[model samples]
Target: MMTDALTLLRTRKSPKVFDLAAPGPSPTELDQILAIASRVPDHGKLAPWRFIVFEGDGRARAGEIIAGVFVNDNPEADADRVAIERNRLMHAPLVVAVVSRADAHAKVPEWEQTLSGGAAATLVVLAAHALGYAATWLTQWYSYDPRVRAGLGLGEGERIIGFVHVGTLARPQEDRPRPPLADIVTRF
Candidate 1:
């Protein structure tokens, strides 16, 4: 099992587009996925990340919230521009909003807590991949928007790490360029 997992990790590729025509994980499967995703090395035992699920009609509502904010900010944007924001989450059947609720008052460094949130996001993607589904961690413009944050029910100090879109792949995934180990790694 360990060898298989390592092989999967080595070859896992993020698909560019998810198949909207196919079904996503069911509620039970998604619960399992989320459970696996939260098993990260969180220093100080601070589980600083929370997951928000968007599926079915919720995706459309969430998209409307994002597009509403976008249109308000960019009043001159055309219909196509507004539609792009409205359909942002349509790429996949399920979307998970990874919210970073890192507390500054914790004994752990805020940076570490924030990093734990990021790890949770990464794990969501990996867990989806291991489940025979494709996922991509995306932080589009809406993620940084204050109104969108409020619409998503995030607290003042909470921030979005990224949104993980998960579903079957619509097409083949292309392997992107990877840097050489020597260029990106160093031995002490």
Candidate 2:
């Protein structure tokens, strides 16, 4: 069992793109995934992360809002560039926006809360992979843009931790070589 778990962990990779797959997890399945993702090591019961699911027309609406913000923010922005930014959300059938919301009164530091949010996003990606879907966690320029945040209705203290895209694999992704373990670890 341990070996099987380790093998699964080792084989997981972030897919860059996905194919059109109907019957992606239903609402119940997504709830299960989010429930598992919520098991990250959070210092307090202050669930610092929230997931925003965007599908179908919602994706297009989000894209339009983002594009509008881009144009409003930069009057000189290229039209094609703006269009590309708007279309980003249309790439996947499902997109989960993971938001980090720090607690002001908690004993845990804000940094820890941020870490917890990141961990939750990672778990969501893994859960998608376990469900036989390709998943990628990304935070592009839009994630940090104030206009985008406003459009998403994120509070002042909240920030996007990641945008997880999930669907069937469009094509097999080639494995990139990894750094040696010795180079990354040092046992005292």
- Give TM-scores for every candidate, taking all chains together and pairing residue i with residue i: 0.95, 0.92
Clashing pairs in 2: none
Name the candidate that leads on lDDT: 1
Q: 33-150, model 1: which lDDT tens digit per residue?
A: 8998899889888798899999999999999999999999899999999999999988799999999898875478888988988888888888888888888888978899888999
- What digit string (tens of lDDT, one per residue) describes model 2 on residues 1-188? 99977877898998674453444667887888889899999887889889999888988999998888878878898888888878877888888999999877549898898999999999998888878877888898899997788888898878999898877787788788999999999998
The candidate maximizing TM-score is: 1
Clashes of 1: 0
The positional error of residue 12 in candidate 2, measured at the CA in angstroms, is 0.7
- How accurate locally, in lDDT, is each candidate? 0.87, 0.85
